[model samples]
Target: MSDQRESIRSNAKYLRNVRPIDPEEICEYVAGNPHPAVVRQQLREEAADLRLIEQDDGTFVPADDEPVSPRRGPVERFPAEYERRLEDLLVERYGPNWEDGASGDLLRSTVRRFKADYLDGRPVEYNDDVAAGYAIYHLPGYYAAIQYALDDLADRGLLDRTLRVLDLGAGVGGPALGLCDYLPDDALLEYHAVEPSAAADVLKDLLAETGRNTHPTIHRTTAEAFDPSEAVSGDGSSDGFDPTAPDDGFDLVLACNVLSELDDPVDVMQSYLETLAPKGTFLAMAPADKNTSVQLREVERELEEERLWDRDAVDFETSAAGDAERYRRGEVTVYGPTVRLWPGETPSDRGWSFDVRPDLDVPAVQRRLDENAPDDGEHAPGEFVNVDVQFSYSQLRLDGRRRIDMALETNEWAKMAEMERHVTERIDLVAAKLSRSLSGGDGNGGRGSGRSNPLFKISDGSEDTDHYAVVTTETALNRPLLEAGYGDVCSFEGILALWNDDEEAYNLVVDEETIVDRIT
Candidate 1:
């Protein structure tokens, strides 16, 4: 398991580099400090230098240099001063937890309730007090999630079309800050923010006081209350901003952490889409909480069912010009409890959450913790804070501009895997039965979810055939086999590996922290 973990990390490091990415993909070749200024310079230079040609379909493909440029990652972070300002706000709220127990507890409780309300899909009515508390306690995370969301788009070249934008529920300017961090230093950008919370004011001031290079118009309005028809276009022309007037429109609309709180997400989403320009973009992001995760899936389904959107996954591979993996990707990373513990074959019950490790100002955070601790303490915030931060984000190009490669119709058989992997990519697979006699224990593979069974075989096809396949121990695919009274087919998807046992025989294995269903 330790060996496999290392392998996965190495693959991730490779993806940070070698993936053939577009020159406009923000910070695609950056690594190390992940400073915004350095990233900004690289983004501009690469875009200008890209010799890629445009296909008749209007999509730009790698010409000669391979749009897939090398990038060093650990994703770009918000500007350092932003973190300083965040820490200062936290310090002021409670004098750096000067009151100790009271302030910390209050902030924690507010965050919990905020998450719960978000999952419950309420009207998102947070007064100034709760909103402020949320900003102070959770802004760092929001900033992290927003950065990841942008990184995903940037990796896919989704940010190039962006110019005029609207940020729904733009709390403390997390997404706005992310945009400024990636867009070229001199890029002409017009931003409009719509939020009900007075925190909108904080977001406006954060952009101004913290020195956001871009100009943004912050509107204190709810997602439902805000009207795109009243929005002003990027150019001085009034028509582009007003969807009703319809000359041109904003390039991107980002609704981060707002959907889970919306009263009517479907209607709200449609309205947001209505505000886009011809080739505009829309992104929705939420925390890794189970219910919010569920909400994002529901929204994805609704978009497709209505035929208003075509879904696509991120691509990671090397290709030039018009050639890239239709959905270039490699394997999946497993997490959480191992073993098949569920009585019913249900992966959703395991509860997957967003895992992110944002580059936080640890010293500043530790200093705050130290101020609350007894004088005799030597604290290591890095120990506790390096843990993965997770969030779910979904993006869509407008109906008219949607990519043809993205399936117009959804695959019914893969629905379970799709919902389970709402945030991450998984290699689709179907579990083929091995001789039952080879199995020793009842559903308990004994090994954790990461352990795959040697006896069970894996195949990618619908029919049971060993024409071309690998053996897997992935308990995620095994649960369905465990549940059925008698069946030969189950589903599985995860990071794939080929290992040689003591005898030196190669065996294929897929890790399982997740449980998948077998409709067959």
Candidate 2:
């Protein structure tokens, strides 16, 4: 069997650059004349290793070398195919009309119980009912949120075409499915998911809907227990694997919505960073709520600019030499969404920042579940709908790449660290717009008036306190603050910086005199 597999691989390698390698045609050349179906299955297993893409005609072709391009527009809706797939899974487990009866009661109570636990900062176990409930309530928003977070990497051509990815605590395949969809059709993906729950079942079913070139493996284990070196190694063992090898690491490591659930998030994050390729990215995300978002930033700051050591290289007996050797390993840096624009400064503010995108169109399953809620004095109109796309994400890299890398000159722009001195004075400043409009009819706190001023959270990575940019008057010159997307850096000229005693933050007032331009 091994000899036949090797013979098939040899033939495909020779024909890959020449033309599409058909499994049936290659089967004729194998030692024992294995069946074409067996050859096809063998090729599917080796596609990632051989860098081949399986086609619809049961043939294999070389994957394109170009990186996946950044998606240009907002993720308006979750794909219908995945929606139907989830419904199918629900039907298989619970009967048809799963939205009502005993199944409905179980799912509704499961969602409410977990939601309450999350609000109170308690961990919720991922049993079968909880997994299905999570899928119906959280899948659409999470699926939409990840693509937006990935744009911070894809925009700079950082995402690769031939990709190896590790997804830690990949609950119910929200981020996994989002990433598969984010890549172009020609891109080849080797996805390894670390999830130890019933959610893995749902994830496995949903991943089947991904493109043919995407090869997925679900490791039914926790993030801490899963060995990264063994997973990425060729022979599935870590005995002779080199942790420092360039090609033996994942191109992207995702820890979305999982850090807040870990006991030691910083140490776990550092461990994963050592397994990242030279130019790979580690994207950590959390819910937009205050506690989780703040905790995510806390983990990011704890690991930022800190050198990580190869655990095997450390000789505990020789402390001095070990410390000196470990210092040369690597440093973790924040890549984007949040900026470290100033050369020698880091924000010490509350760091409660989040991005709000256009709400996703509600999925059919969510609507069905919500509409069928029993009127036992507990059901709200839209209790089960999870369409809001609000999330907080931090992109970390060991390659020292930042989405916005620019030095702010003190003579030209006012540093956020020195905002106190410039308060009550019209000043020029540069900042990344971190949040969407926080005023008007939006649920976010602000005036309830229909004609309220547009307010945005802005950061320049040098503040010890929170800062906001308020557009009091709209004009052609200052309208960019309202038009620019989240994480966009805008230049504010002749803007009045005032201290808001009520909010305990600086509000940069942009009126007719202010010229706000988005720096591309």
Candidate 3:
């Protein structure tokens, strides 16, 4: 068996660049003439190691080396293939009419219970039923949100063609599937997911439907217990493993919607950041709710600018002899959505920032569940439809690459930190539009009315307190504040800065006198 495997690998290495390496042909070349099915299984297992992309016709070819082009527009809908796949899983668990029977009631209650637990800041365990319910309730929105967050990296050409990604606490594979579709077909991906729950079973089933170039492995262990060295080395032993070495660490580490669930999120995040490749990105995402969004920023702030050292490279006993400095790994820096536009400034406010994109077209399963829901007091019309894409994400990179890498010149615009002195006075300011119009949005937690002035959260990355831009009287010139997309930087001319005593936030009033222009 060992000789057959080695002979197959040898033939593949020689034939990969020359032509399509067929498993049938390789089987004939093996010492004992192993079955073609066995050869195919072996090829699938070794695809990532060999950098081979399995073709639709069961042949293998070399992966393209070009970086994936960034997607230009919004994700309109979840793919029908994934929707069907999730439905299939639901059917396998609970018969074909899953949305109408007792199974439907079970799933509906499971979703409501978990949602309530999340809102109340309680730990909800992921059992089989809970995992299925989570897929039905949260999958579509999470799928759309991740793609939007990933745009912040892809727009800057930071995403690579050949990628090694580590997804921590990857539940039911929403972000995983989104990422798979986000990359171009020619790009190769080696994905490792750490999920220690029944969700791993669901994740494995969904990942099987991904593109041929995507090779995934699910480590059935907790994030804290899963050692990245095992994935990097392909073995449990980490002898002489250097995480900082090129081609050894993950290119992207994702902790989406999982940090707020951890006991010590900051420490765990710091440990994961150490496993990032020199030019890697660590993206953390959370729900748009105030508590979770603020907690995400708090984690980002705690790890920002802190230099991490490669523990394996540093000799702790010889640390007194300058060993630590010699083994310095990388410094963490915020890479996007949020900004640190000023050179020496960082925002110290309660950073409750999030981006809201167009809601996705509801998936079939969600629609089915919602349409057939019981006519009970608890069921609302749109209760099961999870298509709103509102999320807070922080991209931390070791390479010091920012999505918006402009240093604001104080001579041209007023700093948000100094807004106190300019209160009630018209001033020129440059800031990123962090949120959509809060005028009639649900972002105000039912406090805002539809007829109120157009309000948005804006940040220049130097404010010590929350700063908002309120469009009091929208004219042709000041309409850009309302027109700009989330995270877009805009320059405001002659905007009045006022302290809103009721909201306890600084409101830069944009009126007829204010001229707003989106700075690309």
Pick by TM-score: which candidate is best? 2
Estimate every model's Cα lDDT from 0 to 1: 0.48, 0.87, 0.85
- Ranking the candidates on TM-score from highest down gives 2, 3, 1
lDDT of 1 by residue, 1-520 (tens): 2333233223333433555333234233333334444433332222222322233332233333212211235554445677576556666666665325776555545545765666576545576556655555556556666665555445545565226678988877777876666565334456788876778766865776432225567787888998776565322234323552233456778888878677789888876775666556677777765567657746754653343322234454666665455532211111111111122232322222233344555434433443453333433333223223456665665533321112212342333223333323444444333223123433221212343343442322122112112334445454555543111345554533333334222233444543456544
What does each candidate score in C-alpha RMSD?
17.4, 3.1, 2.9
lDDT, candidate 2, 149-264, per-residue tens? 99888889899899989999999999999999999887899999999999999999999999988889899999999987656422233435453566667889999999988999
Q: What local lDDT score does residue 401 receive in model 2, on the 0 to 100 scale?
A: 77
| Alpha-carbon runs more than 4 Å astray in model 1 | 1-71, 76-78, 87-125, 209-213, 233-240, 244-247, 307-388, 399-520
For candidate 3, the lDDT comes to 0.85
lDDT, model 1: 0.48
Assess candidate 2 and give its lDDT: 0.87
Q: Following a full C-alpha superposition, what root-mean-square deviation does model 3 have from the true structure? A: 2.9
Give me the displacement of residue 231 in model 3, in angstroms: 1.3
- TM-scores of all predicted structures: 0.54, 0.94, 0.92
lDDT of 2 at 481: 86
Ranking by lDDT: 2, 3, 1
What are the runs in model 3 whose C-alpha is more than 4 Å off?
24-29, 33-37, 232-244, 310-325, 445-447
- lDDT (C-alpha) at residue 16 in model 3: 92
> CA shift at 382, candidate 1, in angstroms?
10
